[model samples]
Target: MSEQDLAGKVAVVTGGGRGIGRSIALYLARAGADVALCSRSNGEIEAVGEEVRALGRRALAMAVDVAEWEPVESFARAVVAEFGRIDILVNNAGGGFEVTPLAESTPQGWREAVEINLFGTYHMIRACLDDIPAGGKIINITSGMGLEPRPGNSSYSAAKAGAHMLTRCLSLEIWDRGIDVNDIIPGLVATTNVDWAKDRSSVESVLAEFEGKSPPFAPSERVKHPDELGELVLWVASMPAGGPTGQSFSLARRPF
Candidate 1:
């Protein structure tokens, strides 16, 4: 409602079609950043772009699969061409139920998870490296599970943990260049994924049995919302000059 940081900046949010990604995109736009939204679906992302424009900031929506190198590169180039430069990159497009036990998981499923969660992030980071100028920021969406392993989420946990490390490594490597890189480990947030499970009686049954707790831990007293995560992201991305970098922060109150 008032003038905020990130005004006149340009940001790209992968998986900006819906859920947390959509929240992040809108948050940035509201803060006055020209935003580019990308996802595998054009319609949903375009809808998000419309919201960005309504916020009085320029918007571009592109259908892109971050796992694919070519499309990722093209998306980066398009963002630069349309906005002139990239000031922020949010690698948020990664998740799935395929994080089953190793014995029950298929090789293809394993690779797919890794490719999308790990390699996809790599592609976007690589493509945007040159476009990110001094004072730019890179934020990777990691899972709390990545900080502490989830027994049944081998694939998801591995990829996210790798991504967390990747963020730190990139931060160290690029700090001298004046680019900041950080990772956020968000705990359970009520998103469409949770909604889908709620629709399926089986998922609901499982959840009910757990008493709202993640495995290996007590039931979560509260679940975070997507917009909550988005707010934290917008704040960090729009941090004033000399803000912290090469660090990881968790959204949940869990002691870690």
Candidate 2:
């Protein structure tokens, strides 16, 4: 808040309607960047867009489904036309429709998982690559489930794993372009998608339930708020040229 570190930069954020995406977009806007954000929900994204404008930064809100190429391509074109260039690209539109084990999961749901989580990230990068100049940044939202194995959520695990590889490969291919590509592993965040927070009335309640001994994680592990991720993203985005690329910045204390 003290310094407008991202001033005059143009940022494009997918899944900007809510949760982590919304927090990232707002953080960028607060740092004085213009934002072009999209999600499937018109009203939700529009509301976020208004908030950006209120922060005295520009906003372009669109209803987009990133899993589809045509719309994403069109959105990229529109962003270039409206904002001139994109200094930051955040690929955040993804979720697992089927968390069931492979046998119990419908093929439709499994494919949906890959299409949105893996293919969607690729689509955004391909669409926006040309418009992103040197020194620009592409941040992919990744998951620990991708780096490891998930018993009941194989589909999501595989999809995120694919995305993680894509991030690394793309970094090697584009490092010469002066564009830094990396991933952010958010760890255990208290979003609506999380089981513990889904039924809980507040984040406080969720934290209380997990206090002293959070399951599936070490007892010392603590759940994070979406804003914590926003702050982490800002730090990464604020890094100067020649910083770490092809690396996954993890919030979790996993040894791996």
Candidate 3:
């Protein structure tokens, strides 16, 4: 694809304040797409919006909690009003809110994980579907844990697993509309979300801790940079119209 492959397009990235969302948002902007991004962090979202503007693209940043239908609906309206249409939507706002064992976890906390990871994705897509004309792309950021269950992360696993199926089901339902819906599994990323330290500011700094070795979770797996996922997302986003849909693209060494 050319450097300006996404020129004139508008992309919406959730959890765009930092980590994978931050990288993907900037990558789309550098490729010539105007970006509309949101996250719960007002300062982080606004900072990313400025970065997009600095790269010479229009940007709309808001403090939106993707799990809430009202905010998501409002965001969709704002995007249409500001950018006129939505060309790409990246559903990346997710987390293991309560990482306790399912048997011992509180009902609300366990459900909150599903609410954010799965319902949040649904809200963004439903809200923006009308504005996304033919040839639009919807990429859901999934996880290996979703494909295969992980201990103490039952809620996130269940939520992402649901999203995985949603991508496939949505693609089949929307095939006639010419939209491509797919999943991106960013395995062992060095995002603060994965790091136990909770210090999520710099991707490179986190990766540095693992230098020439692998992360503890996977003895043979090397942690990946957030920018690498950006590259993969760019490739998927740059695919020709009417291209592949309902597929899972992964960046991990281990098999899912």
Candidate 4:
């Protein structure tokens, strides 16, 4: 597809303040789409919005906690008020605690994980469902652990897995309405979200260990860069009407 495919379009990206979300927002802006960036942090969202404006596209940055329905709804209203329409939705905000043994996991930890990864995504999708017109796109950012069991990170893995299934169900329900829903199961990506020094001395030391665990045959043969995933998001969102939908795309090589 060409960059102009998204020209004059409007997209809302939750967690668009930094990391993969930031890249996706910028890519959409570069593709000529007016973008609304939402995150819990106003400073980061505003910064990315500035970048979007630099790309010559209309940008709105709002502080939104996607887990809360009110903020999510307010953000949607704000975007519509400014841009007059919503053409795409990227459910990208997510959070998780460090891996802990299932036996030791607390109810609070599991609840937070479910709230952020699953409920947050649901709120965004639901709030924008009617806003996105026919032929619109919805991309849910999932994780590789969502596909298979993540022994230590059980709460996060379970929530993301449910989210992946949620994407498929939404696609089926909305197919006749021309709203396409799909998901991206990104492998480990280098992001500030990572707790690099939980046990290691520094980020550099942690990164060395991470690099050693990298999968072969993967694009770049290492953990993905945030912008690399962003490029894929742009492609999926801009794909022609007949392009793939209701699919789970993995960014890493399949172990089997």
Candidate 5:
């Protein structure tokens, strides 16, 4: 698709204040889609909104917690009110609160993980379903942890696995409406947020460790940049109707 192929389309991205979500919002704007972004960080989302507007596309930024249905529903409504319709929904608001073995993981930690990752995705999709027209696209940003087991990431992995399954189930349920749902499993993407990288003293240090480690299966493994992931998201959103659905695309160094 051309750079402006998404012209006249509207998209909503959760956790769009920073990281991969921020990149996705900017890329979608670059592709000519008006974007609505939300996150708990008001300053970040507002700054991203400015960046989107700089791209000559309409933009809306709101402070929201996707884990909470009320805020998500409000966000959806606000987007529709501002843009008139929704064409793309990227569920990217999630994090691993505590990476510990299942036995050591607290009930609250597991609940938070699942609610933020899986339930948040569900709430956003449900809240925006009516606004999204036929042929709309839903992209769930999952993780390699969901596809392959990791020793200390049980809670996070379980939540992401649930999200992966939700993508397939929702794809089938919404098939008649012409909406396509898919999951993206990104592995070791380089971003500002790297709480898990305790070994690295800085972001650059973390990235350096993965330098020249691009996996054969992915475009790059040397710590995939956020924009690279945005490119993949744009490709999926630009697919022709009935092209592909209920599929999981993984961009990771290790095999799943």
Candidate 6:
């Protein structure tokens, strides 16, 4: 698609202050879409908003925790108030509280995981359902761990799995409305938020390893950059009203 395929459209992205969300927000802006972004961090979202404006697109940045319904609903309303309509919704804010065996996990940890991943997506979708027009798109950023079992990250995996299922169900439920719902499962992406020290490898090495594996979605055998994922999001968001929906796209190697 061209950079202006999404011209005159309005998009909302949760957790759009940094990392993958930030990339997606900027990409949408570059593609000629006005952006409304929310995250827990005011500074990050504001920075992103400035970047969006630099691209000659309208932008609104607000502080919101997607786990809570009130703020998400308010955010959705605010976006419509500012932009007049919502065309794309990207649910990208979520993380694991802890990586540990179920027996060793705290109840709070599990709850936090579920709330941030599954419920967070649900809240964003529900809040914006009415605002989205007939040809709207919703993309959820899940993880490869959700597709397969990870011994230590069960809580997070379970929540993402639930989100994956929700994507399929919502796709069917909303098909009559011309809304498409899909999930993107990223594996071992190198982002600023990742702690390289914990992995005992440089970003270059990680990229090399990932490329050598010949992942399914990456035929170029190159490291998957955040902006590249943003390109994929743009493709999905620009799909025709009756195009593909209820699908899961993965960017991970086997065993991820």
**Residue pairs of candidate 3 with colliding backbone atoms:** none
Query: Whose lDDT is greatest here?
Result: 3
**Residue-by-residue lDDT tens digits, candidate 2, 109-187:** 9999999999999999999999999989999999988988858888889999999999999999999999999999988
Q: Which candidate is the best by TM-score?
A: 3
lDDT of 1 by residue, 1-256 (tens): 3435788999999999887898899999888899998998899998999999998999999999888999999999999999888999999998755857999999888888888888989999999999898999999998776778668768888888899899988988998889999998767665666532344234235445445556344354345557887898997897765678878867776765
Report clash pairs, candidate 5: 214-221
lDDT of 4 by residue, 150-232 (tens): 57889898899899999988988988878888998767677777653243453344456666565332434465668888888
Give the C-alpha miss distance for residue 27 in model 5, angstroms. Answer: 0.8
TM-score of each model, in listed order: 0.90, 0.93, 0.96, 0.90, 0.92, 0.89
Q: Clashes in each model (backbone N, CA, C under 3 Å)?
A: 1, 0, 0, 0, 1, 0
Residue 76 alpha-carbon offset, candidate 1, angstroms:
0.5
- Model 1: residues >4 Å from true position, as ranges? 1-3, 195-197, 200-218
Error of 3 at 145 (Å): 0.9
* lDDT of residue 122 for candidate 4: 93
lDDT by residue (1-256, candidate 5, tens digit) is 5733999999999999887898999989999999999998799899999999999999999999888999999989899999999999999999946778888989998899999999999999999999888989999999887878778878788999899999999988999989999998777777666654434554466667567764343454557667888888998999888869999887776678
Error in Å for residue 190 of model 3: 1.2
Evaluate model 1: give its TM-score: 0.90
- Looking at model 6, residue 188 earns an lDDT score of 57
**What would the per-residue lDDT of candidate 3 be over residues 62-128, giving only the tens digit for each residue?**
9999889999999999999999999999999998568888788999998889999999999999999
